[model samples]
Target: MIKRALVILAPGFEEIEAVVPIDLLRRAKIEVVVAGILPGVITGSRKIRIIPDYDLGDVLEEHFDCIILPGGAEGAENLKKDIRIKELLERQILKGGWVAAICAAPGCLINFGLFLSNKFTCHPSIKAEIPLSRLEENSSVVVDGNLITGRAAGSAIEFSFEIIRQLVGEEAVKEVNRSFLSNLPMLGSIRKE
Candidate 1:
């Protein structure tokens, strides 16, 4: 059976956190549905605009193998404030599906009382907004039970790798990483000699 993943996009989402995972999951042959909280285009924190495949209302009743939430301060708040997202998350949890959140989005899980495991990681800046029982330290990504949480934008690649590893398998991760790692250039800029 084909694995289906749902990515929820709200206005001011973190583009890297959403796009990287969506791309990697597709490469792993997982069917991904990008759902926007609003109609038409959803804009990112960096002002990058994306047109979602469907509105959130369209997929509320659909069953997904995994549901992903990407973090930006405003985006996360928008998601957290919506009772519908909370209801959707509760349903996903009850069905034993994986719940993944990155950056500020993890805080949404905490606010909704959806943290099945104590260990989690989120954008450190969000630490002040919510009270955390325990946080997994020095990790770009934390996977406790069916819950997966990632740090900031810098960790998006590793975050997606871990997600693919979960939804697919280690072998698919190896195959994707082999190609991705080989193509990534060194961090520093070139010198015009």
Candidate 2:
């Protein structure tokens, strides 16, 4: 039922964190839409310019099956300040839609009061922002309920894989894993015991 995955980008977003998942999701034949926090171009922390497909002001809250947030200090801050974005996250979670954050952006999830008791991992520097007990150290990705998180940019690929698995299923994950030759040390690479 999830045909499209919507990614929200703001100024100062970590370019890798935002782009990797978009790329991976697109490769899986999933529709991706990059939504801007505002109505203009947003620059990543590394100075990568992203032209969003839709602006926040113009998007309907119900159009996306998933919403992803990529971390960069300013990007996280931008998402937090938008009440509509916050409301969308909450509504999406309640509707059983996938919601994800990577790196420092997960702090936005925490600040929105969405991270309590969720099993998640974030950049070590931002760990204190989340109130999760079952924290995994040096983890690439963690999924708790409808919320998924990745530690940092270094984990972006695996984080994206985790999202792919969640959206499309293990078969798709296996297919992608085969195509990418993903031998990286991440949760997705581990064979289930």
Candidate 3:
């Protein structure tokens, strides 16, 4: 069976956090649906714009193996304020599907009371917004039960890899990483000029 993933995109989302995982997941043959909270194009925190495959309303009834949230301060705030996103998350969790959030996006999970007992990681700035006790400060990514949280933009690749590892497997991760030349030993034996 093909794994399906839904990635929610809000205005001012982090582009790298959104795109990197989508790209890698597709490479692993996962069906990724990028859904915009609003209609049409969504702009990133860094001013990058993306056209989502579906509007949130259009796919609310659809079932997915995973739901992902990419973080930016404004984007996370938008997600936090959306009742639709909260409902979807609750349903997804109840269905035993994966819930992944990165950077400030984890704030949305906290807003929904999903992180009360889960160890998670998020952008440092979000620590002030969420309880410090539940935050895993030393990890780039934290996976507790079906909830996966990533630190910040810098952890995008590793975050994606962890997601890939979950839905797929270590073999799939090895195959995908091999294709991207990731996780390979550096040729330190070669000297550069």
Candidate 4:
């Protein structure tokens, strides 16, 4: 039943972090809708332009089963600063929908007051920015309830795999990993609360 997911992209989004998960998820038969937070095309941190599949204003909140956020200083900041985006994230969680963010995107959760006691990780630069009591270093992807997060862009594969497992199952994740020739652990670290 993992049919559709929403990947919200903002300007200055990390190209790899934003695209890889979308591509991987789609390859795994998960429908991913790229939602542009801004009006028109969005430019990544590397200045790559991506036309979103839909604008945030155009989509209904109840249709998606999950929402994934990518990381880049400006991108994450933009998502965090918008009241509407924060409200959507909060609603997604309140409705028991899956939510995942990688690298600096987890800071958005902290800013929106959603990172409380959620074991997570972000880029090293923003490590100090998150409330220390909630995050753990050296972890690949930290899935605390519905909130799943990974450290840096380097962990995007693992992050995406974790999402695949949540959406599909361990067998599906393993098959995808094998198809991609990935030798990394089939599952990411499961941090004990």
User: In every candidate, how many clashes are there?
Assistant: 0, 0, 0, 0
TM-score of 2: 0.90
TM-score of each: 0.91, 0.90, 0.93, 0.94
Question: Per-residue lDDT for 121-184 in model 1, tens only?
Answer: 8898887644555575466787877888888888788777777777888788778767677333
Clashing pairs in 1: none
Please give the range of 10 consecutive residues that has the lowest summed lDDT in model 3.
Answer: 184-193
Alpha-carbon lDDT of model 2: 0.82
Ranking by lDDT: 3, 1, 4, 2
Model 3 spans with C-alpha error above 4 angstroms: 184-193
Clashes of 3: 0
Tell me the spans in candidate 4 whose CA falls farther than 4 Å from its real position. Answer: none
* Candidate 2 lDDT trough over 10 residues, lowest sum: 184-193
Error of 2 at 141 (Å): 0.7
Worst 10 residues of 4 by lDDT: 184-193
Q: Which candidate's lDDT is highest?
A: 3
In model 3, the clashing pairs are: none
N/CA/C clash count, model 4: 0
Q: Better model by lDDT, 3 or 4?
A: 3
Candidate 1 achieves a global lDDT of: 0.85
Q: In order, what lDDT does every prediction score?
A: 0.85, 0.82, 0.88, 0.84
* Two-way TM-score contest, 3 vs 4, winner: 4
* Residue-wise C-alpha lDDT for candidate 2, range 1-193, written one tens digit per residue: 6468888988899999999999989887778998898788989999989899889777754477779999988888888898888888888877889888999988888788874677778888888876656566566787777778888999898889888888887777777777778787434532222
Q: C-alpha displacement of 83 in model 1, angstroms?
A: 1.0
lDDT, residue 157, model 4: 88
